[model samples]
Target chain A: MASIVRKPKDLIAGVLFLAVGIGALVLLREYDMGRASRMGPGYVPAVISGMLLFFAAILIFRSFRGPQEVLAAIPLQAPLAVIAGVLLFALLLRPAGLVVAIIPMVLLGMFSISRTGLLSAMLTAAILSAGSVLIFVYTLGQPIPVLGYWFKG
Target chain B: MIELLGNLQIGFATAVSLNSLFYCFVGCLLGTLIGVLPGLGPAATIAMLLPITFGLDPASSVIMLAGIFYGAQYGGSTTAILVNIPGEASSVVTAIDGYQMARQGQAGLALSTAAIGSFFAGTVATLIIALMAPVLAAAALTFNAPEYFALMVLGLVVSVVLAHGSLIKALAMICLGMLLGLIGTDVTSGTERLTFGSNELADGLDIVAVAIGLYGVGEVIANLNAPAEQRTAAGKAITGLLPSRADMRRIWAPILRGTGIGSLLGVLPGAGALLSSFVAYAVEKKISRHPHRFGHGAIEGVASPEAANNAGSQTSFIPMLTLGLPSNVIMALMIGALTIQGIQPGPEMITNQPQLFWGLIVSMWVGNLILIILNLPLIGLWVKLLTIPYRYLFPAILVFCCIGAFTLGNSVFDVYVMIAFGVLGYLLKYLDCEPAPFILGFVLAPMIEEYLRRSMLLARGDPTIFISRPLSAVLLTLAALAILAVALPAVRKTRDEALVEE
Candidate 1:
């Protein structure tokens, strides 16, 4: 293993937990932690954050000694694209509406796959947009708008 | 016995109505559809389906939702047996022996064994619920804040016992869940605790977004990260759909044992089908004449867990329906659906809304029967579904989840929450951390805080009230024992070896 990165699994989990614990401690720093009899919003959280640090410490300690399971770095392309695609849809849904918003989302998702032909990707995008309109807009009567403000009344 | 039959008769009358039946059919079909899909779990499905329940009457909505829960259990085993992947958490055990059975060309027998075993278990569990709920509900009536607090404490400890791997990590995860649950405005103080001034934070995190992001989106990411060679093809092609005569005889005992274990544990508020299936698998392996056959296509492996999980799914409802405390995320969604209809789902359900209660109970049996028909004959359709590439499949699920989150409050902020958790879920998977305990922790955290406050108020700030009461004392003792037992090195080592990851 490289000197810079040791046990990734335990290391990552420990770091994650530590950050959460410390962050929570800071966030609840000012809230009134009432007595045990009548606890405030911060009481249970403070106690939990303390325990989080305890467990996170053990995990970080174990990283130096325990055997490794996953040493390889995680692949990032799929998740980033997928999450970004969904975010884009959410961003565009109200302003551009389902019909226009869905196109970019489907196109971005298909682009991540990288094997499908460009024409079919567009074809699939068109099909998905129509299906979304049919199911969510026409049949289910879900409150989503079909067209953007430019097209609608 | 006569009273049980009489109540069932009323249930039958209410459930057999056209509206209830239609919704039951929809729930079962939708459950199976999502179950066969690799990334979506029943909890996510139910959470995503929450908006649909807004318009329906309480009885029909619940009946359908209950059908979806068990129906998903049945569908999950199908994927486990065919492909090596488990479709849900409880089906993780089923994959070990089930995939082996399929590889050995007994895929048909494995699927049929699962179908028959699940049907048998579901029918019996439904009967158990009918017999036990009223009396159990009556007992629950006497429970107070101290008793409830103790019970939740026991529930959390039991959750630790059920989790695989390190007990410390499980405890930590539960604690983290409670911390997250504490976000949003404090109901008592009228002050926002973790909401950093955002109006969206006022009501706390949207649960459906969190659940789907963790289970649905996290699963897709994990599948993507899996080595290509390990993704293994679904076992050849399904052949005959019936087990050998001797096979049936051998399975009956394991099925019965599984049902007993499931029904017993499922009634516990925090434990559910996931716990039952694991215990059943371990017990079957322990008692088997050939324990080595476990990962090598043992029919008993498939039979026991399939039965146990379906039974666990049914009995898990007992605590939820009776106490209004959800045993799992799915039931939590059921509570969400009911609360949307202006009904607080607790002990009063049986006494005040008998139609909704009884109809839901009866609809479960009908749902099982419908599942049997769907699995046995429609096996080919599911096989067709199995061939769809993950590339095409995952994006659709992602899009649906986005829509589902948005529909909850028609807000973009909830969509952001789902994405954030989706990334968090992947990080946990990288650490070999299991999401099951985290989920249980998340669901129970809000209630734990509420109960602790009330109990303390009643006791006039004396913490001893928890131990001074008889029932609470007993429950707390069990929780303590659970912790102490796991702290033992020998027990911890054995548990790490026993658990199977999905």
Candidate 2:
């Protein structure tokens, strides 16, 4: 006998919504819920969370009814790498300035593509960093620093 | 009619002034540049440029800003078609079939059709604004809290109709968006609701951060997940820049229909521009004999939504000009620009400052014409953007996204929010939940909450306020009917059938 694993996508989405709803409800509990006529800060939010929980329950319940859409195969590397690149840019922006910050950001993003070489990636990063400095700092006068304190000035 | 023509004549004279024409050209060019880029959108662009326009006279200031408004709307479609990166909510529908058309070696056809459709829609919408400005504004003035609330409901339901995925997932996405929207300090009671002890969350999530992440960065992540060969740019497939006669014939009716829908919806308060394109696409799909062609490479799909969004953006000005009520965020910025000029926008704008009013109107037509002339040539350059390798392109796009987010508030906090949403957006896509509805929900949440609270308080906590007033009742009834239409078995069967056929 085959065990049922119907609609894994729906099942996952249901659990996701369920977590979001429960988390929202738990967070909202810290605030005061006023009466309907005279609402406090938490009145509308409490209602929204309640509704979210209700809908989430429905989503979870329906996930078990029958098999529907199959879960799509999603690769984890590209999205994570791109996100890491953005995060690294953000972390470095204030400390290292655009020229220093852009290299790793661009390198990580270039890593998302399979065929990129280290030399070419660094070359592209250098070009983009210089171009950005020219466009944003020198031309547009955005007031961004060329080198923050972290750099050996 | 003669009076209308005379007003337009006066408008032409004022708009024809050298200063007005020059400012208008500058605004349109700037708007197009930002709109084509993935990370930045028109709102942030306008906010950044707002101070620069302060030194100019009122007409030039408003005219330049207005040019940016519509020009961005036009340029946004170019990005949507070529890269599946819809920089604006209005361009999201266009990306559905527009991007597909690109993959089929019809990128040029899609872009040309969008331009032609947008031009036609802009002309018609401009005429409508001139002809029926007073009548529509007068009608719009009657909207109270309850009516506005009902309209928000209708808009949300309309967004659901436009989603091409599972209904439950879309609704869940919308609710999730609303929950996320409630993250900032509550304007009422001066209470901080969902900040989670972070000062950055005090203003709630920035819509620009959300928009850039969900659509722009999220799309990059999605694209990168595919195999290298499968993820090739569509620029290599381009054959020509003009649509065939057959394609034009297919899209014309949809274009007209979209224009009508957009013009009418644009006058309503709150999220109207975002709603019009979705509603138009939904209507086209329902009535199409070959519904399967949709979400594939249907010419009608590209033509209709493009026309609708442009028309909607144009007519959304009506409320701001005549009633002094902004229908969308860009219009709100325009109001700010007007106030900065020490001018109050309302009925008095026409009677007291006819020169400014008429000049702005006529300048819009001129600006639209300029956009077409500016955009068509740039299509070649924009298409070449697609030819760049993904490795280089992703880094450039990532940098643009970072700089744009940082510049919006000059803080890196917004970039963090963008990263978070990028992850959420990727996850939502994996689950078949669309970011479009979620974004719309974020846009509409504050307006919806304010209206709901006001309506209830005004009615002494009576829920019947939504059904008591005739207009509110009618609007709520229509919203309910729309929900039913989408939810009913027969309609679901047809939609499902279309999905299966596709």
Candidate 3:
């Protein structure tokens, strides 16, 4: 088999990190008045930023010399699904309450599970949500908001 | 000695109460169960349970939670051995040889040896804690800001070695993690660092959100992407729950050595069960007569690391209880729990609450006995759980993670943070970078920053104080040496070779 060529993503990441470190140093310098013996608030940041820059440089250099084979790629679909799930969970957490929000969250989360049918996913999600509600909300008596009108009033 | 005996009597009186003993058993059982599960860690579990402990008495709640914390260490090794997955970072080294042994049909022997070894270590560690608590507390009182800053520096450097990858890559990741840690409001000046104008970022990234996201949710995502063929059952039979005589003989020396190593390493802040397991395994590999048997089916391979991991987990409470310093995330949660109970954790804790302190120490021994009983008999049950369908298991794990994240502060924002970190974790894995060092950096950054600032303030802006303090100077020198040692070409080559083998 032909040798798998790897990308220089490490170098890119290193450069980005180095820039941020340098920017942090610059921002610290803008706000401080100090000598080595009479340091200001910027001292710690300055030191850390300097260390970060040095390490980032090493990373940039090593990425060039290191072996180049990509082991795997992160799937885009799963991350997107996870993001949507969390947002939906957060948005409807209080309004729709714990029971309502958990179902959709679980559904979106299981979207990434390969070969899982929709019916099984929905059923699994429902069971899990109900179990969590029973355990954490009802049984444990944690202060999670239930969607009862009496409580709201 | 009489006074000590009197104190022990009081402690036993406090701990032997039916309610206290019951909670201790409950905590250990739950801890072991959670520990055996692949993606759940004690920190997240404890954080989830913290609010629930509000109703219980301070002593019982603390004792039970402590049981769970150490019990999880014992439980984590099961998953590491049976499957290739480590339940926690401490168990990662156990997976190195434990899973290999499982593949060789020695899963029963490995699990039994680990259980017995952990019990032995737990017994010794509790004794050490009981005898030396006062001295350790006194020593811890001498630690100043400069010392703590130097210690954190050492921790970050040690993390590079622990990464099992290119040193430069690990350092890069550490820096990035620290940067992520700095994204919230600055502690000293009250100004935000990298919030990007988001209100949620003001209090900083919750460690629970980050950990649960990166380790738990991230693992789920990775599992989903794994090939179907590799995901099939290993079909390893776990018949016997007891090790043979020869197995016992082989593991004896290793277990003792691991206990010693673990007890010492556990006292160092930020180096706990995880590092102890790795160090123990490395030591065992170095000393074994049949060194090559390590990756095949060496019994010592499982016993030593598991014992060391448990010992480290037990003794890690030294810094937290004695010095009021929360070394890891679990200890941090314990601090929260204690604060809730109107108990201040500090140097005078043992003096102020003598019975509570001694009772907790005594209870640790009892907890260990309970763990061995709970784990050994239930090995068959846990092994059976391995046969459960992944589809069903994953959904329940997801629900647990959601509940865990939401309950951190009862905030929805934490859930969002978890999702974001989950993505980052997946990306990190794809890039072949380890998440453990990132976690160390995230956990240690704020503390390091705080200490560095305090050190400077005390020194009246003199940077020379770090060099002037003998302890700080030595620690900084060690940190520098650690970085240089790994950065050396020969060392890097050896590490690369090891990774290739792995």
Candidate 4:
């Protein structure tokens, strides 16, 4: 009730949409805005960006009048751990291969689970890596190297 | 009728093959497995499994993918009943009465009710598809650029109307999706637009990457954000896998009514299955004389929504099959699957890829039959699977997602794209904006632009061509009405109330 913005979630979403709309418009500013009969590469995008800005404006305006809406706390640890695991897997996949890439990803991802011990995490990582090799490599015949350059070299 | 029979003959012939049958079984099984688990949804699972279908023929791949969708509907009810956790949005209502029945030690009866109801609904839905898809496709065949453009507009608008949050925000999400979808080289002019001077941006964002990132990796982060807890099955043991004769008498009406509502609603462009179940649940509660018993172990509550969700899932395929328009995210992924297999889904598919189209329809019925066996006699297996903690379950899912993104083009860059979307998806969730409209808008963007551009060319820049043509005019008018309806105060209140039940 004390906050100036009535609906916090709406405020954030509106701001995000407005930024994206402006960014798109700025990016496509140099491109040709061809006639309706023949649209340039930028034509449809600019129109869409304009529409986005319009909607964003309405949302922002509405945010001032609506009953208060509370935004949920964004989870930092869980997403970060999961994203880190995936990123590491991606980075290691070609260089370190599937086996090398999967283990760390699984291990790092275990941090998302509260009160988990090292033994269980390592077990899950080992089992998951083995299973990934069996399924993605040998069975599915995905063209991924099982052992990365680090191991082969 | 004779033509319908002929088409069905082709469908059964293709669906009955050992290859198709085997893959169909695998898809239903895997789909059920994911559905029984709390965290994974059909969209994410299908996205993760997409690379696996690359080696298969188009018909088999689509059949398998479709199997996953409806199969999840069946498996979702199992978790809802046993563990008080609906596996997906469609099953959220199912958890209410279904979990109550389970707590009353009637888990067997509830499970059987769901299975029988879903099977009956699935059969009717399959037949409806066989009968209606050809006609719908024929109707769509008459559409030109202006009509298609208008229809896409209506689709996006309807999706926004059906979404559960702020109307303007959903529309904004649609525009954002369209804008993002326009990245990379422009199809008509053959010029790179939004690459930010990157080589990977040349081909545009990969559909697989976007889907997996939004639904797969993004969802995992969201689930992990929730407090962890071990889930247990309701009641000590399951028994009496068949409903009594009296229970059956009570359930038949709800199942039939639910199937009818679901079939009608599922053909619309939105989260048709999810909406149908909620609507069906509300309808049942309204009509039942003993409505007070709804949340307290009422068998009607379990039967109606289960049947509605299954039927809704089945009929949601119609729009995708006939118009090449995805009614929801799963259908979007199905279109992605077809595109990967070098097939363009449209009215012409019936003529050009009849085997794939007809076979997919037939395989749904076959998959339903398999689901009965999986859910009834094999119910114990799924109950055991419910015991697998989320902590152990999520890592495997993450691995699959990572590898799936990597395999899309065998490039690590695609994985990076997935991570970025994952963050965006989480942010959108925090802002209470649903991702469904955004995804549908993304999938339809290029087509919308193409149709709009072509329509202008046909009319020589006379925008009235959309209004001048009767069909396109009607479609656009409907779209306008949908927006106006949402903007109306009375309709807005009812819409908010409906979603508030969740």
Candidate 5:
């Protein structure tokens, strides 16, 4: 079971890296440059991509040759929540402004951890958002946008 | 000698100013605070502060930033000793003996020894910079693009020694990082290579985003998944913060050796504080009378690595200030700050901007003094911070990471990029891959590419340029020899043994 889990990830990552390297090589061919003597625009990319291919091949070969060591599996929920929270924050940052965006983001993060309750998370988020607004916007006078209603005249 | 004294006097005069002193204090204080907090290191702090330094004079800005660099080194050891979690990669070695000391009820002694050793090393390193800056700068003048490329190659090769896992995996991660570094618009051609038509990616992935995502957020994710029992506090008791007479004696030789090793290795591009600590620990173990004490509560183990880390943090500036070449990501940000201030850092900097150069040197000493003063009194306060529940702490870290990433470009895209890298970082961790070499590869790739191109151009596309130029030839030969040495069967066998032990 351990060997089965480890093999798939290694194989996938190896294939992905090789694909990216090949893609880079393909893109390099599109760049127009004069005939190469010692160096051209694509020379370094070609060399780097070639090396990547070589390494990826080695990784794949090694995976097949041995039973890879397996570690404990990562829990899925918290990471997923964190990613979702970050994406939500990014989406709402401009339209909702700093305070509104940050409050939800903080709450989502706190929820993901499972130690902090709803009331504590909300209270913590509000306090932190206020503090950040004061420090960044009021004290330092950075150009960050505040909530429209709270904007200074 | 008189000239040196005069320079020192000028440096003191500049550093003693109210504004410079204030910034230095602020930098050191903030650095220690961040360092005590797990997952935040000098690189993130410096990068976040880069834009703020734009309005200040170059000398004052540099002084504050330099303080943060060494201050973090000192602060990182505190956490490593107390909590068994290293705040930075350099502190990993400190964790070996430091955590053992904590477990054995000698946390206070370990912390004090580390702090004192760091202070001593900091003082001596500052003197080395003051005395040796001119000579080093003069020597660095001979380096051209080919030599620079060769130097970077050597640095990349040296970083492979950092990985305790499969060399193949380490090398693969490095190549992966180099490829990721190429995802933005090409500077020379003005054409987007890997942007995938996203306009936000035209400027490339922010280093802040990648670093924070990989180290900070990924660490949080990993920690949250750990079993509840393991997450429970150790609740170790504390005592006086002084080492015994024998403890001091055991550490003295290691501290001196670390200082010597650190000061020399610190000048090399890409091998900065972190590598110095690793090398220092290895050397100390090799030379120790009781090598078995290393992974236990050995004072020398903590003292040597911490001192070396701090010393290396200070001297890394030598390359950036003297040769206009940044040794790491933080120094790269500093270059941008200097350029915005209309100051070019090179051999001519000393002659053209004496006040700035000397002022920075002077400020470093003040910064070290300030860090020691601020840190010793604040150790108790920092210790209290560790008692805060991880649930509350992790959210705050996430907020800071997000804000820091967003502030880098005022674009939401950087935040997304950070999250992506966070996932990649977690994946890498699970796969037993070291992220440091990848960072080295990413940071050095562009410079390497530019140098290779220029070398060829200078030689009129001649294939023999690498071998024809005597300096380039020598550097290339060294790189080749290093690769060959590592690849040799005898060396490989030893390296494999070392990897198993590590």
Candidate 6:
């Protein structure tokens, strides 16, 4: 038996939109929705959410009727590695500081490439960390510290 | 005529100063450097470079940013011609005939043609901006909230109309962007709308963070997911740096036509540079004596689109400068730069910050001339840069993205925000959804809401005020007509055909 949803991408997008719209409405539920002439904080958002929901419903309906179109396979490794590297940088920047943060970030980020050897990646990370410290910290004087609580203490 | 000359004088005086000139050179150098890289588009390049301009004066920063823009346009073409890799979307068509020219050992000629054509187009486009911007600003000064609201609607719809993706998907992206944009505290009521109990969300997402994540990081991931190929320069020795007289004579008319088409199309909202080149190439092919020569080292193919993209990119600054409404993502970044400098972009900027306005316009011409020199004489330098491997490049770009986001308000929260959006952007790409309209919507959302609220207040909540005002009515009518036009099957098919070449 054929499934009702012919276009899985559209269905996913529609559901995403649905969640965002309903979530926005839920969040803004407590805010005042004053009359149109004197709109409160929630008024414009309420209107936007309604429109989003309407569009979401249409997308959901259309997904079922449209010719079957398969979504492309989403690559997980590269994006995840890159994102994890960024998350590490974010987590480390304040506590471990810029120098400590950048090396691991660059090293983890280089893992996205399948061919990169660990030695080269480590070298690249060290060079990048030093160069960034020179440019961003020494030359530009960005507010980030070189060493944070971990090293300072 | 007198006013034009006087404005030009102010522009030249400001642009010629040692301060602005130095930054302009730096900007063009950096823009060219990054734009030569295969995976780095102008948007990502600009986003990553935004942090560097934080300390400079508004005029200097703007001048440098504008230089980066057109300089990137120039560099993208160099990559397109020599390596057959378009560094940016606007250079996609240039690769068609440009790479062929390189293969035929006319690499230098092709590079020179693109540079010369772009310089010519840039000069003309700067002149157009100088003449037209003031008049537009004067007219926009009279626009009330309702008219502004209608204009934004027109811009959003026209952007979707020009988008190459599915109409429904683009519209959905617009809605999504607007919702994300509304996350901060409401300006009127001083109430937090969608902060989700987080202090980081109170200020809303920084434009720089969103831009870097969506374009810089998302693009890196996209490039990494694809099969990597090694790129080599087509010709070892690039001879014929100058076009022959016969070649010059053949290209002059196409350059003029391309500049004309690009200047006209660029003033419209959407991806003007990308559209201008596509349309210019199609027009050139249509009018050519030997249309069959287009993809096989046709100099006209190289000249017209190059001129069109440059002209289109320059003229697209019109709305951003005069109306303070960014027509594209690059303009949005420029607006972000202006905002950081405490300079609000609007019609008032013409009278209030004449130096910044005129200086930027003149700096573009200066920057264009610099690009020609840098691109033609130093062509070998850029071609050498194309050899940098993606493995090394992607990590460096990620580092920049992380630092760029961190520099935004000195907040690691912004870095986290960038990561979240980066993931969302990657997922959205899998659904075949473009991020351009989404970015535009994000930039325009607060303005749209502000205008809507003010218009409603003025009209005592009557939505009919949108149609009652003559100017607003006309703008809304155009928006409606544009939506209808794109929805029609015939027009949709033609749009598909026009964009399919890229």
Best by lDDT: 6
- Candidate 5 has a TM-score of 0.90
Candidate 6 residue-wise lDDT, B239-261, digit = tens: 98999999899999989998998
Docking quality tier of candidate 6?
medium
DockQ, ranked from best to worst: 4, 6, 1, 2, 5, 3
What's each prediction's TM-score?
0.93, 0.80, 0.86, 0.98, 0.90, 0.98
Model 1 stretches with alpha carbons more than 4 Å out: A1-8, A65-70, B228-237, B243-247, B268-271, B285-296
Cα lDDT, all candidates? 0.81, 0.78, 0.75, 0.87, 0.75, 0.88
Question: What 10-residue stretch in candidate 3 chain A is worst by lDDT?
Answer: A1-10
Q: Against the true structure, candidate 2 has what lDDT?
A: 0.78
Instruction: lDDT winner between 1 and 5, please give it.
Output: 1
**Model 3 misplaced regions, further than 4 Å:** A1-7, A19-43, A148-153, B1-14, B41-58, B89-109, B180-200, B228-239, B243-250, B268-272, B282-296, B322-348, B352-356, B493-501
User: What's the distance in Å from true for residue B130, model 5?
Assistant: 3.2
Question: lDDT at B238 for candidate 1?
Answer: 74
Model 1 CAPRI rating: medium
Q: Interface RMSD values for the candidates, listed in order?
A: 1.5, 1.6, 2.9, 1.0, 2.3, 1.0
Winner by TM-score between candidate 5 and candidate 3 = 5
Off by over 4 Å in 2: A1-5, A151-153, B1-114, B227-364, B496-502
How far is B171's C-alpha from truth in model 3 (Å)? 3.2
Model 3 chain B lowest lDDT segment of ten: B226-235
Candidate 5, CAPRI quality class derived from DockQ: medium
Q: Which of the two, 3 or 5, has more DockQ?
A: 5
Clashes of 1: 0
Model 5 has a clash total of 0
